[model samples]
Target: MKKIVWLSLVVMVLLVLAACGGGESASAPKESDGSASGDTASTETFTYASTSDVVGMSPILTNDSVSANITEHVYEKLFERNIETMEFEPQLAESYEIKDDNTWVIKLKEGIKFHDGTPFNAEAVKYTFDKLRDPATAAPRASLLEPVDTITVIDENTVEIKTKYPYGAFLASLSHSNAAIVSPTADQAQDLMKEPVGTGPFKFVSWTSGDQVELEANEEYWDGAPDLKKVVLKVVPEISTAISMLQAGEIQFIDNLPTEQIKRLEAMENINIEKKEGTPVYYLTFNHSREMNQDPEFREAVAAAIDRDAFVTKLNGLGVRSDSVVGPQVFGYDESADEAGTAYDVEAAKALVEKNGYGDKPIKLLTANRDNFILMAEIVQAQLTEAGFKVEIESMEWATFLDTARGGEYDITFLSWSNVTGDGSELLYPNFHSDNVGSSNRAQYSNPEFDELVVQSRTTIDQEERKAILDKANKVMIEDNAVVVMYHGIVTAAMDKAYSGLELDPNGKWTLKNVTGE
Candidate 1:
């Protein structure tokens, strides 16, 4: 039954791709009245193209990149990273303090109000978190606030969070757009995606499902009215189409431009290209709970057979080879962690397989039908077969692949980890911790000592102390053959020269709150 659904979704996705030309430009919407004009900085509407439509606005249901991108424009987090320095700064909150091991005392910034005119105060903070923590909501991001046991309002402008354990990354986590605070008066039970009200510089205006979304600048924004009056997010699922649209002047910006097309687009007179080192690690996972692939010997052999440099060069032309699950852009990635366990030694791989006495069992490799992943998986299959293991390949749609991978159904699967907090803890706990088994731990690999280290790192507020713990955990993970760290992806964006103030977050997001036109 699962296989049928997977095949059907693949067929539908292909049909959609076929119906639209892969490289043709899309037409832009007609300019709306009161849109931003070039003559003045105020009142401008910018049309932007993205490769996919947001799955939904509900932060709990899905963490789709497209949805998060659009939501960032309409929501405001308590803290945000400074564009120039990439450092955390207060936004909704004026300041905060770690008064004790498990307490975070926060002071709300005055004169700031939600788009709906509700006061942004301590009560609002408590209400927002309470809704997110409610089990009925099933918010996908609820895990982000797992440390907080309760939020207490000390006064109208003051609040305190008492956590079950000490967490140094709490403030960094708040900087994520997923942690955006919403108004308590805006229907606690409302469909957040369809109707979102926050203290952002822009307010949700309209959404044409699978087509476009519009936003209007908040004139009463505490910082000041946004320079642009309106913004339009156009969903164009094909990367080629997005680039073409930008070239034709129909769209002013195209996010996530494919590396292959970047060279061609660079020659265009009206486009501007921006490149940033991203913290996304694209790697393959082995189902350690499965009988055939779970053997440490077989896993290590497979890891040794594949060439990391080749994968990066062929599968991802613009990415850096990853030595750890945490990318170089992450805060605590140890430069000299471990490099002794695995190398592209096919002979060594074969010797290990023979030593394990797994004569010639065929291993199944799974990946989404996406272009790059399919190519990567096929290459891996070829490499493993050469090293004395029979291999079978399976391809499915992205959503189905995610479900099956999480279920531990595949012997091997292609996956990417987008660290939400830009911290080592985000990588350590989700994919390696025993408690996260059958969820983020698709590998089902566990080590009691490694788990303890992760837990200790999370509650340890000292930077150097947490780093030492995480470094040890990373070393354990690599030596155990838990999962192979492939490459850290480089994020690339192509925008019209007319658009400015576009910035990339460490999490591979492009924020447009301060974007302006020439």
Candidate 2:
């Protein structure tokens, strides 16, 4: 009986070992020689966290940075701006030639197809521009195509776009995601907002509203299949929550990292930090529609009262004090001119306020409820109060704030613009031009001299001539206190060390096509 019991125990232990070994064999890649494969390739899903909800995928409908960031990955423009060179390179279109001052002939790339299997050609380009130009669409970026008079499809692969004028920034505007090519077939979808179809490396898989957006690698991508098989953009409204997710390995990348947590994040092991000087100017814009803000003295008083250096300190020294509307990354930024602008002078501000007859007038400073905006507004509010203005701070959610502010409801609203085109015209034109009042010109600022300078800058093709025109416009706007140009934010992002090949563009774009999960 003892010999039989010992034999049974030995058999049971051997069976357990065999089962464990079989499980390992199933997980490991097989070799023809029946040996260990020794392959080091990884197949991991990359998760990125964003602080704001992506508004939608419609290229022309939204101008928010968050929407642009997401659309960039899912759409391919006729041209793309090189991150290092800051020059326009062909993406959807193979090549382009300026036929004359107003006409540009573009050659489409052959054999490229949208994700919906629609052949991308001259007709597709024409369709995209037509949709954008149509008044019924009411595309928020419709004004971008106002100069484009006609898109003529010369052939299946050739297109000619004629502008109303010789627009110097035409090619640069094409580089924007708002000018991305779309599949005409897919455009028929009743709910195309949730179903974006483009020739990008990633295909939209699912968008769980505000929770997350998921994309999968397009194996048939024209460029090549992406290394990462999947991408998940998890909407984390709070930076602190995103930080916790990053530490817990729930997210691999976190964009727009709040400056307050950088030091703590840097201390963590296997975490990488990427910081690039971006071309976004965070400023306080006045609604010229308001009688009080319409006064130049009042605007100058508000600009002179706030200490930009103190504001930068409150931002945790994460940005450069912006003295001009255009940042250094743009084409026409003038250092001397920027430096010669306004300075913090309490007495000067008070004198200007008295001169403007703004005594005891209730000035409401409206701002988004985001951490940075609220904190910055509070500081500005205190400064304005000390300067003897009846200051009040009003905060609301981002979407609500944008709607209310753009409707000319706010006396002073805090906002920012990411100059994604890398052009001084992009920074100056839409926001200051009188025609752009309902659009990017939230301030309702209109000056014929500034308008003429901007129009001349956009028309002239000479690089130096354009710079001179834009510099003059910047000087005029700054001297008039068009807006209190606060500072340009530094593009700061954090990622897990496991993720590689992430590149930050100076235009404040987060490029993820080359980024891979190790």
Candidate 3:
């Protein structure tokens, strides 16, 4: 009976994968004759597999990479970052200037409209900023604008911003997806979390929960319509199934390419692989809200028990061993400070566990059931058990795991954060600040001095001064065992030979602005 149930479950997963797979059944633009058109810029429907499901489409609420990637195509920020030049280019705003140490004035681009036909003007920008600043909205990225005092509209196209203090990363932070401008109605509607209304190249079509989110190009876009008429972000959490779908021409791209399958995939005639240095930090966080994980000695025991070299090797070299919580790709990464944080020493870990009397209960390690995460958890479990600590692994779907971790339901959880803004302020403030306890600070870890340092980094205009302040704060967090620093990853993606011009930004965001199909 157990075998029958297992086989039935396997069959169900396969059926779902087959239904979600690519082929002629994929959504495409209809010709004048009401028939499916051939692969071209206008008719090709590109289906791409994602490793995790999107939490929600509301740009201000989600902090995950997958949601950011999807929302970016449907929403527009005031400014956009140029990957090649590393400069900010105007998107919704035509020009912006700093009037004083506490004031910024922005001129919005005229004649722009949301997909819902709402005018994109100074009022729209003000609405978005007001929503972000309101604590009732509970925006996860609200801390990005903690210094802003108020936003005032000077005219139809001009908006003035006054800050409580001098903010160094204010303009750069606006480029983040969380700062995406939305239609006034959409921002206030209950359905906005699921149905996004924005001014971008694509408009939200439909989202099949846990399966896929479909988007159609906005033909009336200010920057011109996208080349691909329809795009589907399919949730295929299994790497093996995604590869199979890619080969079968059911899916056009694979975002979570398995490192072990890279050699085999490269040998395929139709597959092209692209790689870039990732700005994400994959690490373990202890829920300081819970008593079991609150002890500094316990966190150190957990950190020292594992071998970083083995962990990297086990992932088939998909990432480099990260000594710092912040990746080297992000600013304010001090090598010497990170080196002094933690190291593998089984004897010391066991000694700490014994000294702290921490082996009385089992530590629940929560993680998503991804291939790499499970492997890492198993290795860590073995090491922790060897160090005389009771350990148990609890696995769930990616979305559920995220929800559980955010609710502080786990003792420890394996997670990764992508610093998409490429700024040191972004790296430190959200995850370490006490104000972010229920949001990005999954650890629920708080320290008064650490919080002050993070604020100091944001208030200063000098980059060197900000870096120095963060360096000291980072070292303090390490000493406190706020979280376990693991490794930095590399972004690996594979697409069919038919696709072109897909660019992966250094912050690990794939922009579809220039992607085209032949």
Candidate with top TM-score is 2
Report the CA-based lDDT of candidate 2 relative to the real structure.
Answer: 0.81
lDDT per residue for candidate 1 within 77-110, as digits (tens), equals 7887764575778888899898889988989898
Clashing pairs in 1: 36-43, 36-44, 36-45, 44-229, 51-237, 60-139, 60-140
RMSD of each: 12.5, 5.2, 10.2
- Summarize candidate 2's per-residue lDDT along 1-518 as a digit string, tens digits: 99999999999999998987754332334345332232322335778887767778878677778777777887899998888988899998899999899999999899998888989989999999999889898776676777888889999999999998989898888888788888889988645577888889888899997788888888898989888888888888888888876765556788776777877777656468888888888898888877777777888899889888888876665788868888888888888666756789989998877776675779788898777787779889988877878878888866677777778888888888888888889777867788778777888888899999999998877889999889899999888887887788888888777667888888778877887655
Ranking by TM-score: 2, 3, 1
The positional error of residue 312 in candidate 2, measured at the CA in angstroms, is: 1.0
Choose 2 or 3, whichever is better by TM-score.
2
TM-score of each: 0.84, 0.92, 0.90
Estimate, for each residue in 322-363, the C-alpha lDDT of model 3 and write its tens digit: 677767777777887657667899999999999988888888
lDDT of each: 0.75, 0.81, 0.82
User: Who is ahead in lDDT, 1 or 3?
Assistant: 3
Off by over 4 Å in 1: 1-44, 83-86, 187-189, 315-317, 338-341, 351-364, 369-371, 388-400, 438-442
* Residue 487, candidate 2: alpha-carbon lDDT: 84
